[model samples]
Target: MQPATTAVIALHYQNEVLHPDGKIRVGLDSDSPVRQNVLDAASAMFQRARACGLPIVHVRIAFRPDYADLLTNMPIMRGVAASNAMTEGSWGAQFHEQLAPDTGSPREFIVKHTRINAFFGSPLEEVLRIVDAKRLLIAGVATHSVVEGTVRHAADAGYEVLVAAPACASASPVTHQAALDSMSLMAQILDANALAQFFDELPS
Candidate 1:
């Protein structure tokens, strides 16, 4: 089979200081812990994507707290009343060390911020369009939010979307699974190893 030119997308909850603590106070089902596992899986997936010369994109959540001067009001940003942790320039805003890629130069980072979906308010769609990417491999934190948001928009935009089952985590297991179940009907869902195998079988 021909190698599918793909883009691997990962969402990061670790923003600067103005964003909410995505899962610290949440329950066991919360995404914090699960997000880590998802990230680990994504890292492994990236190895295959890299070998296939596919593009990798990381979505970040960062907000300018000035509600008076907001860009577009998205569902996730409805409560702009106060910022929790993710800001523009804080350690918490940074991507978890494990999920962050080493590009050897700060100038080139996969990180991109958006108000809602990875494609919304961000240059993601444009980038993919430039690369002529037809398939998107997605995994991220807050399956209910970023992951869902991205998938819906991606589908509407007419791109083939795939969700990395083990590469996603949400605030609750129910929410996570629900999102997966729903997306599965519209997109292909695969784990890291399965994804790797797909890429491996692809002809160069």
Candidate 2:
């Protein structure tokens, strides 16, 4: 693998998803080992990709302030609506500081998405195409949701997908593990350290 052959897609690292004080943190244990692992792993993964000169694309879930684009009838969207999380201009919608794009890197891209799959209505595919990326290294919150959704979609779109398991979290550890197991059929699953090693070995 080379830097040009791979791009890292980080999904939904917004304050509403990763921060302890986030609006959607109700009933979630902020101090859990799983949660901490995700934060640390994802932060380190981002740093490694940046250092290796790989394109890093950050995907965020956000809706208009009026939430006109939000699907309020959906159970998850209802919860999101009630919590008022990830509104376009809200603080909860901003990317986590640790995983934010480096201002100095022209290879960094930030894309806003309204759907679970990052590519549904975003420029993700176009960006990846522009970078000539044949593979994607994925990391993010909610292993059962964004991580799985994006991986499946990417695989279907003809991109080889590698998931950083330790860099993903969900409200339930069981659900997270189950999602990872299922996704293994379509994507290669690696831990944060392994993902770092993979990128480090990529030819310059």
Instruction: Give me the candidate number with maximum lDDT.
Output: 2
Q: In candidate 2, where is summed lDDT lowest over 10 consecutive residues?
A: 25-34
Q: Each candidate's root-mean-square deviation in Å? A: 4.3, 2.2
Q: Over the full model, what C-alpha lDDT does candidate 2 score relative to the true structure?
A: 0.84
lDDT of 1 by residue, 1-204 (tens): 223367778776353311234423223333345545665686777666666666677677664544443454564455433444455565666777666765763212365664657776678876676666798888776677778888988998888988887767765789888988888867888865777677777654
TM-scores for all candidates?
Answer: 0.78, 0.93
Each candidate's lDDT (Cα)? 0.65, 0.84
lDDT by residue for model 2 over 51-141, one digit each (tens)?
Answer: 7788999998999888899977668888888888899988899987777778677898889888888999999998898888999999888
Q: Judge candidate 1 against the unseen true structure and give its global Cα lDDT, from 0 to 1.
A: 0.65
The number of the candidate with the highest TM-score is: 2
Off by over 4 Å in 1: 1-4, 13-35, 65-75, 78-83, 104-111
In candidate 1 the C-alpha lDDT for residue 97 amounts to: 66
How many pairs in model 2 have backbone atoms within 3 A of each other, for residues 3 or more apart or on separate chains, i.e. clashes?
0
